[model samples]
Target chain A: DAGITQSPRHKVTETGTPVTLRCHQTENHRYMYWYRQDPGHGLRLIHYSYGVKDTDKGEVSDGYSVSRSKTEDFLLTLESATSSQTSVYFCAVLRGAYGYTFGSGTRLTVV
Target chain B: TQLLEQSPQFLSIQEGENLTVYCNSSSVFSSLQWYRQEPGEGPVLLVTVVTGGEVKKLKRLTFQFGDARKDSSLHITAAQPGDTGLYLCAGDGNAGNMLTFGGGTRLMVKP
Candidate 1:
């Protein structure tokens, strides 16, 4: 889908540790987003980037931060991992009006 | 605080049965999209309805958007086991260049 890729497909980290998830795209789409999927809660947006160096917070951005230093890369960092943050995180690139193209996602576990 | 709500959070049916998933919202959207997600993978876009009252069909799946552009539905006819996955509806927010997703409906079509 859109040549979007996510790194560290799976990871287990201790609580209070910092973890960063990477999303890279080959299509050079200007908009990228990070979301976490949890059972019963659905997918909640953490943050999104409109362009290099431009970013904004989404509904569930409290525990997450994002950086888009380059057009092809968007990074999502969990400052301090918590049990509640253990979930599958997805990276999506908006292909204009056609909608989003998502990466396979990264599953994170905090213990 | 969820802008969009999906009914019947979970559904299980036998193959050949028909099922419809509903996504309702109080606010209007520029477009609505349907996605299917399998276990351990990111969601894949199935269809997008842009106009109010617009209806689109793909194979045995049908998607409909409300006349008010505030709701949408996906109906699957003659369901198959391969159709099992999480179904999500997203509304194009048209504000932040992002989408608002509904709590997905998990569907399982048993053979």
Candidate 2:
């Protein structure tokens, strides 16, 4: 919460549109993650970055893409957002043995 | 498939009540972490328990890692209205590389 920040707290877009969410951190942590929370599904990892320009897909990486061109920023992009993609997205930074610190989250709705 | 399963999806209790929420998984983890999330915000880390049969206390929250390393529990003593939030348990399934989360337990502590 102290170092991580997510932009555009809330957004509403039409189906088939492209959307991007940004997560910025001041802690300079190497591991940054993107997760989506849905009812009955809890939170599922979409993607994560271990370092600048180093990324990997998570359990639910179907229609999502991510980029971490710098250590302080990680971006999650949905090429073609669907109604089912409407949910809360959270950004997290792993702080080694201390666990993770999460951003405030971005709420997205697709109609 | 959901790797972690949380029981008692929802819990409502009066102030000063005690409650326990559980997280179970068939797969063993290197570590387990607990988080509390409030409305419109992402989850914040509460505690991280490594090692089997480990127990950690944070104020009124007591977290226990199962002896088998396949489960964990959170017991809240004298839960107050301030404790009303979604409690989530996550496992580091990849030996601290990635986390697999459980369906959260939503607690409502009415005053």
Candidate 3:
């Protein structure tokens, strides 16, 4: 619980719908990351931001996008949700030199 | 791409039993981290190993980093029902700030 908050702890949306998840942090950490946890795949990085307005794609960024408009807020958007994208998403902030503090997580289901 | 492979996707044992989980990789990492995730919650940091051949202990849990910095192992002694959770291993592959995670080991300590 790194003072991070993810909106809509649980969400269910229809396929092809646009969905966005928000992550807000109070610590003002320099690095923030978005990851999705799925069965048999562990947690895969979707996107990460080093600083405000500075973001980069990760291993599984094809169907996802993110933005960091301010130091405390990072947003992940799915332009068109799909069944394959249903999973538990987590937001994390780097802590100290070698660890991370994660938020509670958001569970999204696309039908 | 750097990948971490974890063995024994699932483990179930009676309380008081001992267990070990391993994380292996083809790529070397600067450091490796272990986390425990409970249902509906995000992963919580358990330990971090930075030096090769390093061994650290926390009460009933012992963690060891391989001499090559390419692998790590966690051993839990007298496991309890409270220890049941999804265990994950992560490393900063390519020396990047982002982490690559293993498939994870689901442990169930039945009382």
Strongest candidate by DockQ: 3
Residue-level lDDT tens digits of model 3 in B1-111: 889999879999999999999999989999999999999899999999999999999999999999999999999999999999999999976444889999999999999
Question: What DockQ do the predictions score, one after another?
Answer: 0.88, 0.93, 0.94
* lDDT agreement with native, every candidate: 0.93, 0.92, 0.93
Question: Which 10 residues in a row give candidate 3 chain A its minimum summed lDDT?
Answer: A94-103
Ranking by TM-score: 3, 1, 2
TM-score on alpha carbons, each prediction:
0.97, 0.96, 0.98
| lDDT of model 1, residue A56 | 97
What is the two-chain DockQ of model 2? 0.93
Clash totals for all candidate models: 0, 0, 0
Off by over 4 Å in 2: none
lDDT tens string, model 3, A1-111? 469999989999999999999999998899999999999999999999999999999999988999999999999999999999999999999976748989999999999
Clashing pairs in 3: none
**Model 1 accuracy (lDDT, Cα):** 0.93
For candidate 1, lDDT tens digit of each residue in B13-34? Answer: 9999999999999999999999
Ranking by lDDT: 3, 1, 2
Native contact recovery (fnat) for each candidate is 0.84, 0.94, 0.94
Backbone steric clashes in candidate 2, count: 0
What DockQ does candidate 3 have relative to the true complex? Answer: 0.94
Docking class of 1: high
